[model samples]
Target: MAVFSVIKLSELEGAKRIDAEYYDPEYLEVKQKLLKKKFVYFKNLVKEIIHPKEIKREYEEEKQDYLFLLAQNVRPLMFDLSEKKFISEEKAKLMPKNLLEKGDILFVRSGNVGDLTVYTGEPKKIIASSDLLIAKPTFKFSYYLGVFLTTNYGQKILIRGIYSGLQPHIAPSYIKTIPIPILPEEIIRRTEILYLKAQNLLKQSESLYSQAESLLLEELGLKDFKPRYKKTYTAKLSDTFSAYRIDAEYFQPVYEEILSTVSKKHRIEFLKKIFDFRRGIFISTDYYTEEKTSRPYIRIKELTGKTGIDESKIIYIKDNYPIDEANSLQENDIVIAIIGDTIGKTNRIYKELSGGFCSNNTGRLRIKKELNKEIIPEYAEILFQSVIIQSQIEKKKTQTGQPKISDKEIKSILIPILPLSTQQQIASLVQKSHETRKKAKELLEIAKKAIEIAIEKNEKEALDYISKSEEK
Candidate 1:
């Protein structure tokens, strides 16, 4: 206290006379208690996994390893572009090393930072971009670490440590130093249970997509479809064509090869029978409305992978708007993205979107009404999403800073036609898969909400129901 100052104030140059006490005993005690609650520990407890092979010091040409890559968002992505041989000297410089191994936990290091994903397949021989940290735990804490990182406490530590600025960045070292409180064994077990449920739901969605693709392939009688273009071979081009002067990527021979393959199998030509397939009209920002009594406008941002349509982000239209002016989405109509890297992505309007309006970027497809087509829109959606179709899109993708698929390209796309009965069977499986996916999403929401409530109120009061059940 100032009244009982042990040291003279005149000795301190910056010191000023104060009537108030220098310190409060009660306040100091409370501060000490809070400081004790701070959990700080060394990061070396968690281990990092590097590529198994060491980089070559010398090279016949500049050598590279499996590409080192990282996911940029909540969704992790891998680029599989190994087919084309003969990398350019300039292009080769940008190539990465460090191929990813299955079951390895991927951690983002920069940009849209701090997302995690566990790899499962043999994407071996591929590289990871420098913006990632692959963490492998010494203890059985990997699963718990994942759950905690996604939890409020984990996110709190992550967010608090972030160096705030424009294009906010969190250093990998900072993320590694984050304190993960030791959770109860019961809580850990429950977290694992929730994790597994979510994993199973994802797997089911993937399997459903696979089944639908197989059905389409069999229906088209091209069950064993393979394109003529070989990744190793250098494609020949005629000098006569001016377009040939451009880069080899512009001439997506793979797209044509696929069209040729389907043409051989189908009894009827899909191109001839179809009425129209083209990109939608792009509307300027001035035309958009903030609110309306009628339909909501859809955008590519609204799209969720495998989740289909989401209406929460939609914009409203005016009631006085003319039907012709309104961007109406009809029943069973297919919506496909036309611009940017996500081009060729497709979704079908089902019961949920019985009547809605999509964005200009979303291409609309209405099969000829007279076709009386029993062809499930879901089935067609599955076909477009198949690896076979996606491979072609990648091969043909015109990269202008960013990769994109042309409207002309999707218009000429081909699919195999199956018996109506077989199509129906596959559609049934898709419907069931959708139901499971929806339920899985709901359960995940409940689990997250429970965790939020637990953080606000102590675990005992928040999870009292679960605790009582465990006692029984």
Candidate 2:
């Protein structure tokens, strides 16, 4: 179906956009409704907008680090810390403008216009990447404005603000011209309160996940364990004269240190003894689409640590898949990244991700019938993510060309068998963590709906709506 819009010359924007989409009737309708109430320009709502910069960074370990946030970390209503990277404190201090404070809004100026999220986490802890437009809002305006812009009317106005060119981008100069509809002061105050509640819930969620990891490591006696990494380590001539080996990196002592620690605590079992493999099938890039209505294609990068897909980075399969292939992943299927940037990453398919198609670089692991009674999939994913398994992957994976874990090496990979009760306890905490995060998102949603109702109907009705939503 084709859609057309006719714009009158007198009604055209001063910048003179004749693009058919610029005159979208829906946008025109929203423009009228927004003007019906008292409105102010978006620029008047913020303190200052910080543009992106190219910052030189030095990566560091998790404990001695400040988080480095990429554009993908800025989710719609929250930041997804499932996958994380870090920078040294020395580098973090040098570029303070890049560091995000709580209540600051992280806006995407290009690529994904109108997409932004308020930071509800700790102040000055996370540093955003160069792709984000970090805006420090006045008072609690962050919560009110952030939710409002994501509303249906707000999104359309942002679309109209896009300066179309070879690569469409939104400029701060253009944003200054965007209108923001104002609601009651009390309504804004309540929205701010809701965001704070959401933030606290998210903090609780992260703490639960950490507790789960700590429990697993504690049970395995790897708690408070730090493997030594020497500047220069030596190996005997006989040890270096293996059939295929001349590489120095292959003989790193850190690998041995980790192995020795785990072996002393528990007997290690070869993964091949307990699991069967289901490798994903290859599909051409021609089948990929940005049209999200199509079936999503899950690659290794799409695997979030929370056992879910990163929808912002996810792509859809435009064409019908081959009829004979059993490429579809089912709920709770444990998947692992076997190649490229995310090699060694493992997660289970959540209920929402059941029907998604997996890419060739990823492989699914199913516990053999004999071993299924002993191991839980959730527990397996947690074990795979730990340094116990990751260290082995680092020692075995090819590093010369494309980084990968070989099939032969994977079969021989080590696994620790923990007590069944301990595994269930760890898995239960992880499930609770994921649930708490959802509740946080739900609160943000109530704010969004309230904003919509206030604009469409009246503030009295909207306040009643919030009151009723709270009662429920």
Candidate with top TM-score is 2
Candidate 1 minimal-lDDT segment of 10 residues: 76-85
Error of 2 at 352 (Å): 2.8
What's the TM-score of each model vs. the native?
0.61, 0.80
Count of backbone clashes for each model? 9, 0
Which ranges of candidate 2 are over 4 A from the true structure?
A: 1-38, 62-72, 82-96, 99-102, 108-115, 121-129, 152-170, 234-246, 281-296, 306-308, 311-325, 400-402, 453-465
Tens digit per residue, CA lDDT, model 2, 1-472: 5777777787887745777777888888888899888898777878888885657545554645688877656667677676677887888888889888877888777666777888866735787877788878774577888888877787788778787667667777666667788888988888778777887898888888888889988987789997877779787888767515556677888887887877887878998987877777677887777776436677876776653455546777775655334677777777889998778877777777666677889887778888877988778878888888888888888886788877778888888888788889998998888789778777877888888999999998888887888788
lDDT of 1: 0.54
Q: What is the C-alpha RMSD of each candidate to the true structure, in Å?
A: 10.8, 4.3
Against the reference, the lDDT scores of all candidates come to 0.54, 0.78
Clashing pairs for model 2 are none
